[model samples]
Target: MRRFLASALFLSSALPVLAAESKGGFPPFNASTFAGQLFWLALTFGTLYLLMSRVALPRVGAILADREAKIESSLAQASKAQAAAEVEAQGLEQALAKAKANAQAIAQEARSKSAREIDAKRSAVEKELAAKMIAAEASINETKTKAMANVEDIARDAVSAIIEQLSGKAPTAAAVTKAINAARGE
Candidate 1:
């Protein structure tokens, strides 16, 4: 850097001498200062190259490297977060599926239990009704027997009365019973 500064100061000092050597034409196009122009052009280009290579380029390269590292780091973090989210989602889905299965099992078990209870109750009710029906049938049969007996007695009395009125005689018990039995197709 100090060498570049020394050369630039030397060129600045020599500028007036090169201008004086020009034959009053455009300074860059004048043949008289051609060698000086080439010298100064080379010096300026070399100084700019040295400045860019030694200072500006290294700073820019460092900045670019930092930016790349930041980008990679950010991407890695994002991928890790995405993977974690996927794992959590899978866990949640599994939990939900398990819960659903449990709920269905509970519902099925409850339904079976309720069905069993209902069947037991139905069987009990059926048995009770059957017993009541049997008792009712027996009572009906008894009533029918009693009514038939009373009807037979009434029939015998009516027949005896009718005969006594018609022929002035009463029917005997055995004759009336035999007649009733014969008329019944017994």
Candidate 2:
């Protein structure tokens, strides 16, 4: 293809040189003289035109028709290639869409599963906390009961010693009860 283009360029450049040579230093054509230079110029042009139309023009036209056919065939092939490419692109797009949808579904499922697991763990933690709180409260109450029992014994001993110091002897049970009740105002 490159060689053909180069040769056509060379031939086109040579055409003007050939024309200049054909008319180089030719005598001026006289239009007034019949059967002279003007007549000969006209006859030469008519003969050349007739020869070109009958022989050269037909061959040139055939060559042009063949070139046009080749160009049309190349265009049709390119169109088919483009259509095939478009079809492939559409298929790839559909596949990509399906893949994206599948990925989204998988992600949603994973999120839901994780949420359920976290909720279950939270529930377990809350139950354990409630049990621990109840146990702590029970321990506190037991400690309070033991401490209150020890306080009663200490109070009795202190009061007896005080009665002994004040009256020079320990108080009797009845007197102790009356003192305790009076101290309590009941």
Candidate 3:
């Protein structure tokens, strides 16, 4: 596109020179004059072509080649960068997956540990409660035995006192024993 624009600009600038000198100041077309104009146009075109091909075109071609090389190099660099970015992204994904796995494993371990701890605590509490209940039962039985012994003594004393009050004398041992046994409903 740049080449086409440049060529158009060159042709437009050169038009006045080509139109200014026709033969006889302002003559119509003839074979000889046409031939002359044709010859000069051809000569100019050939010389310009040679100059362009030998010097101008070669320099321009070198510059265009350099630009193309630079552009291709830049594209290659960008492609490498993109590839590196993709690799880094993949690495990050893998790391994240590993981290997630580790976290899950840790959570599972924690859950298992907590369950074991809870079970242990429950068992310990149950054992303690059982021991306390056993102790309480033993204590209750001891208290009941002591209370029964005290009641028997009190009954004997009360019977002896009642006999003394009624007879105005102490009862004999054998009689007291007999009386106590009868009152006991034995």
Candidate 4:
């Protein structure tokens, strides 16, 4: 605070000297001071240019180059990952197709095997039924032959009884046999 007050007192005391020396509307527009102003402006501008070129610009350029290198590396990694993913997807598709084909083949083989089994069973059943039918026919023919043989005896006894009842006498067996044979068209 004391320093500030001393500086302010000095400036106030110098202000009158500055005002008496200056007949300025603006000092920069005064032709008489132009050469000195031009000299200071050139010196300051050259100094700023040198500082930017030697220090600040190179640092900014290095930072930009690093950022660009990181971006390029990231892009390259992304492309490699994408390519690997595509290759894996293609491999999966091929595997899936192979699996589907195998499944179809298995199903077809099973169907044919089942059909063959069914046909075998059907043939066995048909053969059994045919044998049973043959046996049944043979039995019926045997029963019919026995019944035919007994019919002759039954006719002979009936004829003998009728003759005895009509004429009070029985017919001989040979005569009855001849008559039965004649009636039967044998």
Candidate 5:
């Protein structure tokens, strides 16, 4: 249907030129044919204008509208994707912070546990040293008692020798004992 109308418009525009071809050197420049040429030009221009306005231009406008809508939809989708990525980034940051906090807490717990262990070991060592000191003191006291017993006999022998040296005779054991007891306030 559109092909037939286009052909009819074409034929109508071509008719006068076919009729005037034999007589003219240039029909467009001729004074008598100028009115006919102008009339046909108006007819052809009006027909083309009506066809473009009614049919072709509307199709082109619809295509442009669809292209604009698609561009807007793509922009909206890209924005949504970007927002989702930002949210994920925030979540990852939060997770990293939580992990750091957890790591610090664990390290602190380990330090405290090590300190407690060290304290316990130090206390055990201190207790062992205290016990050793007490044993040493007891042993020293036993040795002092034995040395004191030997001192009495050593004093008796010295007195006998001194008397023997002065009088050319040894002192009797009983006399030495009595003298030593008197000197000692026993």
Candidate 6:
């Protein structure tokens, strides 16, 4: 049925072209049949206008509207995706910041702990050194005291020996001690 209608419309549109050709001249330029040509032109134009307005134009308009709706939907989805990506990025940034903060805090804690340990070790070493120094000083003082006591005895013996050699007689211990003390300004 649709083919029949299309064929009929094609035949009808071709009738004027056939007739003009038969007349052996352009009918549109011929003033003698102006009225008839104008009538057919108006009829063809009106039919085409009606067909476009009622059928073809409406379908085209529907297709355009569908395409616009699809485009808008795609744009909306893209916008939503972009927003979600931005939100995720922000979350990542926050997580990174938190991680950095935690790392810094851990580093600070480690540093403080190490510092404390170092200080403690240093203090212990200082205490050990001080103790060793004190012991060394004490040992030196004891050695000096023993040497001083021996020096007094040795000096008295030397003085007595010298007096015996010079006079052919030994001096008394009391006299030697007195002489040594007087010479030492004691």
Q: Report every candidate's CA lDDT.
A: 0.92, 0.86, 0.88, 0.91, 0.93, 0.93
* Candidate 1 error regions (>4 Å): 1-70
Evaluated with TM-score, which candidate comes out highest?
6
Regions of candidate 3 where Cα sits further than 4 Å from its true position: 1-58, 111-115, 169-186
| Alpha-carbon deviation at 133 in model 4, angstroms | 1.0
lDDT of 3 by residue, 1-186 (tens): 999999789968866775786445324435558988989999999999999999999999999999999999999999999999999999999999999999999999999999999999999999999999999999999999999888777877777788889989887767777887887798
Query: How do the residues 25-128 of candidate 4 rate in per-residue lDDT, one tens digit apiece?
Result: 44545888889888999999999999999999999999999999999999999999999999999999999999999999999999999999999999999999
**Worst ten-residue run, lDDT, model 5?**
21-30
lDDT of 2 by residue, 1-186 (tens): 999999789978887876687653223333345467667989999999999999999999999999999999999999999999999999999999999999999999999999999999999999999999999999999999988878766776788888899889987867776777688789
Q: For candidate 3, what is the lDDT?
A: 0.88
Give RMSD (Å) of candidate 5 vs. truth. Answer: 10.2
Model 5's alpha-carbon lDDT is 0.93
TM-score of each: 0.56, 0.51, 0.58, 0.61, 0.62, 0.63
Instruction: Please provide, for model 1 over 1-114, each residue's C-alpha lDDT reduced to its tens digit, 9 standing for 90 to 100.
Output: 999999789988887887788556445556878888889999999999999999999999999999999999999999999999999999999999999999999999999999
TM-score of 5: 0.62
Candidate 1 TM-score, true structure as reference: 0.56
For model 3, name the residue pairs that clash. Answer: none
Report the poorest 10 consecutive residues by lDDT, candidate 6.
20-29
Instruction: Give the range where candidate 2 is weakest over 10 consecutive residues by summed lDDT.
Output: 23-32
lDDT of 5 by residue, 118-177 (tens): 999999999999999999999999999988988888999999999999999998999999
Candidate closer to the true structure by TM-score (higher is better), 4 or 5: 5
Clashing pairs in 6: none
Residue-wise C-alpha lDDT for candidate 6, range 1-186, written one tens digit per residue: 999999789978998887777774555667888888789999999999999999999999999999999999999999999999999999999999999999999999999999999999999999999999999999999999999999988988888999999999998999888888789898
Better of 3 and 6 by TM-score: 6
